[model samples]
Target: MNFCKGKLRKLKQAFKIIYRQKSELAPTGLNDDLQADVMRRIRRLGPLKSGSNFLMLFEQFVWRLAPVAMTITLFFAIVLMNFDLIPDSEIFQLLYHESDDFSMIQFLRF
Candidate 1:
Protein backbone atom coordinates (compact mmCIF):
# COMPACT_ATOMS: atom_id res chain seq x y z
CA MET A 1 0.00 0.00 0.00
CA ASN A 2 2.83 2.37 0.80
CA PHE A 3 4.46 1.59 -2.56
CA CYS A 4 1.21 2.36 -4.39
CA LYS A 5 0.87 5.62 -2.51
CA GLY A 6 4.45 6.57 -3.41
CA LYS A 7 3.77 5.81 -7.08
CA LEU A 8 0.57 7.87 -7.00
CA ARG A 9 2.44 10.81 -5.44
CA LYS A 10 5.12 10.58 -8.15
CA LEU A 11 2.39 10.54 -10.86
CA LYS A 12 0.73 13.62 -9.36
CA GLN A 13 4.07 15.46 -9.25
CA ALA A 14 4.75 14.54 -12.91
CA PHE A 15 1.35 15.87 -13.95
CA LYS A 16 1.93 19.10 -12.04
CA ILE A 17 5.30 19.57 -13.76
CA ILE A 18 3.71 18.95 -17.17
CA TYR A 19 0.93 21.44 -16.41
CA ARG A 20 3.44 24.08 -15.28
CA GLN A 21 5.62 23.64 -18.36
CA LYS A 22 2.66 23.62 -20.85
CA SER A 23 2.46 27.42 -21.07
CA GLU A 24 6.11 27.64 -22.31
CA LEU A 25 5.20 25.94 -25.64
CA ALA A 26 4.91 28.33 -28.61
CA PRO A 27 1.97 28.25 -31.03
CA THR A 28 2.52 27.98 -34.79
CA GLY A 29 0.90 30.73 -36.87
CA LEU A 30 -0.71 29.69 -40.18
CA ASN A 31 -0.65 32.09 -43.18
CA ASP A 32 -4.04 33.20 -44.56
CA ASP A 33 -3.21 32.04 -48.15
CA LEU A 34 -2.16 28.60 -46.82
CA GLN A 35 -5.61 28.09 -45.28
CA ALA A 36 -7.33 29.21 -48.50
CA ASP A 37 -5.19 26.85 -50.63
CA VAL A 38 -6.03 23.89 -48.35
CA MET A 39 -9.78 24.68 -48.57
CA ARG A 40 -9.57 25.04 -52.39
CA ARG A 41 -7.85 21.64 -52.68
CA ILE A 42 -10.52 20.02 -50.47
CA ARG A 43 -13.33 21.58 -52.56
CA ARG A 44 -11.80 20.25 -55.76
CA LEU A 45 -11.87 16.65 -54.39
CA GLY A 46 -15.71 16.74 -54.48
CA PRO A 47 -18.15 14.72 -52.31
CA LEU A 48 -17.50 11.33 -50.71
CA LYS A 49 -18.15 8.05 -52.59
CA SER A 50 -21.33 5.92 -52.16
CA GLY A 51 -19.58 3.36 -49.87
CA SER A 52 -18.31 6.06 -47.52
CA ASN A 53 -21.72 7.74 -47.58
CA PHE A 54 -23.40 4.42 -46.73
CA LEU A 55 -21.01 3.94 -43.80
CA MET A 56 -21.84 7.45 -42.50
CA LEU A 57 -25.58 6.75 -42.81
CA PHE A 58 -25.18 3.39 -41.06
CA GLU A 59 -23.16 5.03 -38.29
CA GLN A 60 -25.93 7.57 -37.72
CA PHE A 61 -28.55 4.81 -37.75
CA VAL A 62 -26.63 2.77 -35.13
CA TRP A 63 -26.16 5.85 -32.94
CA ARG A 64 -29.91 6.52 -33.07
CA LEU A 65 -30.73 2.83 -32.52
CA ALA A 66 -28.42 2.38 -29.49
CA PRO A 67 -30.85 3.85 -26.97
CA VAL A 68 -33.74 1.88 -28.49
CA ALA A 69 -31.71 -1.35 -28.31
CA MET A 70 -30.80 -0.67 -24.67
CA THR A 71 -34.44 0.09 -23.86
CA ILE A 72 -35.59 -3.17 -25.42
CA THR A 73 -32.93 -5.11 -23.53
CA LEU A 74 -33.93 -3.48 -20.23
CA PHE A 75 -37.61 -4.13 -20.94
CA PHE A 76 -36.96 -7.82 -21.63
CA ALA A 77 -34.78 -8.10 -18.54
CA ILE A 78 -37.53 -6.63 -16.37
CA VAL A 79 -40.10 -8.91 -17.99
CA LEU A 80 -37.96 -12.00 -17.42
CA MET A 81 -37.39 -11.04 -13.80
CA ASN A 82 -41.08 -10.41 -13.22
CA PHE A 83 -42.04 -13.72 -14.87
CA ASP A 84 -39.47 -15.62 -12.77
CA LEU A 85 -37.99 -17.22 -15.86
CA ILE A 86 -34.81 -18.01 -13.91
CA PRO A 87 -34.87 -21.39 -12.26
CA ASP A 88 -35.56 -21.49 -8.51
CA SER A 89 -32.46 -22.22 -6.46
CA GLU A 90 -32.07 -23.53 -2.92
CA ILE A 91 -30.08 -20.45 -1.95
CA PHE A 92 -32.74 -18.07 -3.27
CA GLN A 93 -35.55 -19.91 -1.49
CA LEU A 94 -33.46 -20.10 1.68
CA LEU A 95 -32.78 -16.38 1.58
CA TYR A 96 -36.37 -15.41 0.81
CA HIS A 97 -38.20 -17.98 3.03
CA GLU A 98 -35.60 -18.85 5.65
CA SER A 99 -36.34 -22.50 4.89
CA ASP A 100 -33.89 -25.25 5.90
CA ASP A 101 -35.44 -28.25 4.10
CA PHE A 102 -34.36 -27.18 0.59
CA SER A 103 -31.37 -29.12 -0.74
CA MET A 104 -29.09 -28.28 -3.66
CA ILE A 105 -28.92 -31.92 -4.75
CA GLN A 106 -32.70 -32.22 -5.00
CA PHE A 107 -32.91 -28.96 -6.93
CA LEU A 108 -30.25 -30.16 -9.34
CA ARG A 109 -31.87 -33.59 -9.82
CA PHE A 110 -34.97 -32.03 -11.36
Candidate 2:
Protein backbone atom coordinates (compact mmCIF):
# COMPACT_ATOMS: atom_id res chain seq x y z
CA MET A 1 0.00 0.00 0.00
CA ASN A 2 2.86 2.40 0.84
CA PHE A 3 4.65 1.62 -2.45
CA CYS A 4 1.45 2.27 -4.42
CA LYS A 5 0.94 5.62 -2.62
CA GLY A 6 4.53 6.69 -3.40
CA LYS A 7 4.07 5.86 -7.11
CA LEU A 8 0.83 7.89 -7.24
CA ARG A 9 2.51 10.84 -5.56
CA LYS A 10 5.40 10.74 -8.10
CA LEU A 11 2.98 10.66 -11.06
CA LYS A 12 1.00 13.61 -9.65
CA GLN A 13 4.15 15.66 -9.17
CA ALA A 14 5.36 14.85 -12.69
CA PHE A 15 2.00 15.89 -14.20
CA LYS A 16 2.06 19.18 -12.26
CA ILE A 17 5.60 19.95 -13.46
CA ILE A 18 4.67 19.15 -17.10
CA TYR A 19 1.57 21.40 -16.91
CA ARG A 20 3.62 24.29 -15.47
CA GLN A 21 6.29 23.89 -18.20
CA LYS A 22 3.68 23.99 -21.01
CA SER A 23 2.00 27.06 -19.49
CA GLU A 24 5.33 28.87 -19.32
CA LEU A 25 6.24 27.96 -22.94
CA ALA A 26 3.07 29.55 -24.34
CA PRO A 27 3.35 33.15 -25.81
CA THR A 28 2.19 35.42 -22.98
CA GLY A 29 2.40 38.61 -25.09
CA LEU A 30 -0.01 37.22 -27.74
CA ASN A 31 -3.15 38.03 -25.72
CA ASP A 32 -2.20 41.66 -25.17
CA ASP A 33 -1.22 42.11 -28.83
CA LEU A 34 -4.46 40.53 -30.08
CA GLN A 35 -6.56 42.74 -27.77
CA ALA A 36 -4.70 45.91 -28.83
CA ASP A 37 -5.08 45.12 -32.54
CA VAL A 38 -8.82 44.51 -32.18
CA MET A 39 -9.32 47.76 -30.27
CA ARG A 40 -7.30 49.75 -32.85
CA ARG A 41 -9.36 48.41 -35.75
CA ILE A 42 -12.61 49.16 -33.95
CA ARG A 43 -11.45 52.70 -33.25
CA ARG A 44 -10.46 53.22 -36.90
CA LEU A 45 -13.82 51.95 -38.16
CA GLY A 46 -15.69 54.22 -35.74
CA PRO A 47 -18.44 53.05 -33.40
CA LEU A 48 -22.04 52.31 -34.46
CA LYS A 49 -23.26 54.50 -31.63
CA SER A 50 -25.88 56.62 -33.43
CA GLY A 51 -28.36 56.17 -30.56
CA SER A 52 -30.61 53.09 -29.87
CA ASN A 53 -32.99 53.77 -32.79
CA PHE A 54 -30.33 53.17 -35.45
CA LEU A 55 -29.32 49.86 -33.90
CA MET A 56 -32.95 48.70 -33.82
CA LEU A 57 -33.52 49.69 -37.48
CA PHE A 58 -30.28 47.99 -38.61
CA GLU A 59 -31.17 44.77 -36.81
CA GLN A 60 -34.62 44.74 -38.42
CA PHE A 61 -33.17 45.36 -41.88
CA VAL A 62 -30.72 42.44 -41.51
CA TRP A 63 -33.50 40.10 -40.36
CA ARG A 64 -35.75 41.05 -43.30
CA LEU A 65 -33.08 41.00 -46.07
CA ALA A 66 -31.37 37.75 -45.13
CA PRO A 67 -34.31 35.51 -46.10
CA VAL A 68 -35.03 37.44 -49.33
CA ALA A 69 -31.44 37.14 -50.54
CA MET A 70 -31.34 33.41 -49.76
CA THR A 71 -34.61 32.75 -51.62
CA ILE A 72 -33.41 34.63 -54.76
CA THR A 73 -30.16 32.66 -54.82
CA LEU A 74 -32.05 29.36 -54.45
CA PHE A 75 -34.32 30.19 -57.43
CA PHE A 76 -31.39 31.11 -59.71
CA ALA A 77 -29.62 27.83 -58.82
CA ILE A 78 -32.72 25.78 -59.71
CA VAL A 79 -33.12 27.47 -63.11
CA LEU A 80 -29.41 27.00 -63.92
CA MET A 81 -29.52 23.27 -63.10
CA ASN A 82 -32.53 22.79 -65.40
CA PHE A 83 -30.76 24.41 -68.38
CA ASP A 84 -27.66 22.30 -67.67
CA LEU A 85 -29.74 19.07 -67.84
CA ILE A 86 -30.86 19.86 -71.44
CA PRO A 87 -28.04 18.27 -73.46
CA ASP A 88 -26.15 20.01 -76.28
CA SER A 89 -27.52 19.89 -79.85
CA GLU A 90 -25.13 17.08 -80.85
CA ILE A 91 -26.09 14.85 -77.98
CA PHE A 92 -29.77 15.75 -78.31
CA GLN A 93 -29.79 14.55 -81.92
CA LEU A 94 -28.39 11.14 -80.93
CA LEU A 95 -30.99 10.67 -78.18
CA TYR A 96 -33.96 11.97 -80.25
CA HIS A 97 -33.27 10.11 -83.50
CA GLU A 98 -30.89 7.31 -82.40
CA SER A 99 -28.68 8.45 -85.29
CA ASP A 100 -25.26 10.13 -85.45
CA ASP A 101 -26.33 12.59 -88.15
CA PHE A 102 -28.29 15.76 -87.43
CA SER A 103 -31.61 15.90 -89.31
CA MET A 104 -33.44 18.90 -90.89
CA ILE A 105 -36.10 18.80 -88.15
CA GLN A 106 -33.43 19.20 -85.43
CA PHE A 107 -31.82 22.12 -87.30
CA LEU A 108 -35.18 23.90 -87.52
CA ARG A 109 -35.64 23.52 -83.72
CA PHE A 110 -32.27 25.21 -83.16
Tens-digit per-residue lDDT, 17-89, candidate 1: 9997895685566589888998999888877696589999999999999999999999999988788444457
lDDT per model vs. reference = 0.79, 0.82
The deviation in Å at residue 38 for candidate 1 is 15
Model 2: ten consecutive residues of lowest lDDT: 84-93
Per-structure clash totals for the candidates: 0, 0
Which candidate number would show the highest TM-score if scored against the true structure?
Answer: 1
Best by lDDT: 2
Candidate 1: segments with Cα more than 4 A from true spot:
1-47, 86-110
Model 1 error, position 9 (Å): 15
